[model samples]
Target chain A: MPIHYPNGRRFHETNTKKRSPAPKKISYSNRGMTLEEDLNETNRYYLEHGLAVIHKKPTPVQIVSVDYPKRSAAVIKEAYFKQASTTDFNGVYQGKYIDFEAKETKNKTSFPLSNFHDHQVVHMQKVIEQNGISFVILRFTQTEEIYLLDSRFLISYYQNMDTTRKSIRKSDIEKNGHLIKMGFHPRVDYLKIVDSVYFSN
Target chain B: MPIHYPNGRRFHETNTKKRSPAPKKISYSNRGMTLEEDLNETNRYYLEHGLAVIHKKPTPVQIVSVDYPKRSAAVIKEAYFKQASTTDFNGVYQGKYIDFEAKETKNKTSFPLSNFHDHQVVHMQKVIEQNGISFVILRFTQTEEIYLLDSRFLISYYQNMDTTRKSIRKSDIEKNGHLIKMGFHPRVDYLKIVDSVYFSN
Candidate 1:
């Protein structure tokens, strides 16, 4: 039977289960998690441990058509992805509003400016103006190095891209951003940087 | 050509334009908007005027398969809706974290507890524990009346529902919750209630 939410939207538990397929044989050498997966695990750790209440917003989808069978769950037959109007992750932590975007780049020398969208940058600016904690988590995939850069620096660099360098140099990020150490329990472990940068008096 | 976001997801502006089809002939007397639509417009108004920063989280959808046509946008071929793990609307207001769920009911005597889910109640509890503002906006459609009820009252009522009452009485809501007067510009105008209930220091 189709399970319908209070708002009349149908849900299927099977689809959620199918979202993560069966795990393959473990190989430590080749196995690696994407930045999104790492952040998701970190956020889940925060939530389960009663530390924070952050969550990644679902990818926006412009749903077109739906199929309603007599006895089966409603299936979405047609849809297309939509551009998000704000950052991907946000929540409340220690009486503070937290909002941020995470991105991973393969380039070793610098992070490409094209990784961010104009609307996302503007959204981060608005978040900062509202006195929320706003920043970006950047990971260099090749070096396995991650940094939490303040949105102010990002916005400044993004705005000056035409005049200055097209991409932010690794040295500039190292100077302005805080390096995040990967951990066992919470993989990304970004709250430490947030505490030191935004909360430390 | 299909417009692709930096994350490689395809987007089509036409899809968004299609999401809201051409507005039907205006029926001033009979036209009524859903609570979700009202809140959306209200949030937009707040954002534009820089009064507050809030947004409704996108509906969660589990994508099963996608088809990338040679010269067209990537179409979601198979997908299913998933139950959201938290409240629908959340953001920052005057440097404070804000979170809430909104529901409308036709019940004249009482507000049905069925409108809320267990996870949402728990999420609200977590938000309050983090010192974030949490509440519920409920509408009695029969009388076109709305109230903003604190989540603490809601949680208590929900917990003892089996013994005391299956639903919260309208009289109880009238006494405990703040009545939100509908308005022309923002429609619901629930922020006035938030300011009075939460920030009246």
Candidate 2:
């Protein structure tokens, strides 16, 4: 069996064992964390703290061939990536069906609508129809700002994109979206925003 | 870039095109349907009919190497399967979170507990703790009987395996579990059982 980092990097326990241990470095700011990594860490924190049960769905792959060796594990010989049919992360949060996709863009002013595929948008719509708490975690990488925007707003914007701007303006996001505060323990505390935005009475 | 059947079989468009056109085979009575195939078909039906939004999570894989050629899609050079930490199927139905794992056993007398992993059992416990509906779909292939057993019962049976029987008896399941009726459109009408067991007053 193999383990992978949240960024899809392969983890090598043997390599780690061969290296000389060094003191861990501490950082005050969210400098090198990718949105996926932050979310995975946050979900792990939530799971460990008994706050939520969320997981990033595995990358969809279309396996073409596999080799079953004489005395070893079956090895995937040929495979290709498949476009996901649904959002990346989903699970139960406070007895509610929580579903969302996380995306990051380098744009400073607007988040491009092209970042999401049609199927994902449609899937989010369906989840919302089923009364699931559906949203998107958008990160403006240029400014290191993250926002949780409801899927309802995204779907409405996506549907009317032919006449309007191809991207969502930052001002609109700031007004409509909830900012996710960065933290050390969980890294991206989006659920805190979720509680206020979706759960607050 | 490639398509796949519910059984993880690769779909070859070229091969399919080259084959002589033949009428599709028709069958009844759930003669050869695996539990996974049934669940996948049922989920597709639910999705298409706007009934619910359930999906089987993709098998987790850890890619060790990738070959990105100048042209064409990148192929996975080396990859290994990773053990899943959560149940296979999950989504929202009628404003409720639904999570379950489907399994089929060849044994006629009892359903073995070894079919589930400790992590999966723990995950189901967590789901139940969070007030999410959790269960397992057990199929006795010998008799073609399918039962939807709640996670609470399964967890208790699993945890007390040391002192009691290592498997749940067929009679016990017949008494405690709700039978899932076979169908044509959705194949296995498990949600009907879900509604009666988890939703109905």
Q: What DockQ, between 0 and 1, does each candidate earn?
A: 0.38, 0.39
lDDT of 1 by residue, A142-173 (tens): 77899999999999999998855789999999
lDDT by residue for model 1 over B1-201, one digit each (tens)? 223212222232223322223432222321345566678878988988888889989887778877667666778888876778999999998888999999987789999998898999999999999999999999887778889999999999998889557899999999999999988778889999899889999
What TM-score would every model get versus the actual structure?
A: 0.86, 0.87
Docking class of 1: acceptable
lDDT measured at residue A12 in model 1 versus the true structure, 0 to 100: 28
Tens digits of lDDT, candidate 2, B116-135: 99999999999998889999
* Stretches > 4 Å off in candidate 1: A1-30, B1-30
Considering only chain B, report the TM-score of each candidate against the true chain B: 0.84, 0.85
Instruction: Evaluate model 1 with DockQ and give the value.
Output: 0.38
- Tens digits of per-residue lDDT, candidate 2, A1-201, equal 113323443352222111223322222255455677678878988998999999989887777766656666667677777788999999998899999999988789999999899999999999988999999999988677899999999999899897568999999999999998778788889889989988899
The CA lDDT of each predicted structure is 0.81, 0.80
Clash counts per candidate, in order, are 0, 0
- Model 1 chain B — which ten-residue stretch has the worst lDDT? B1-10
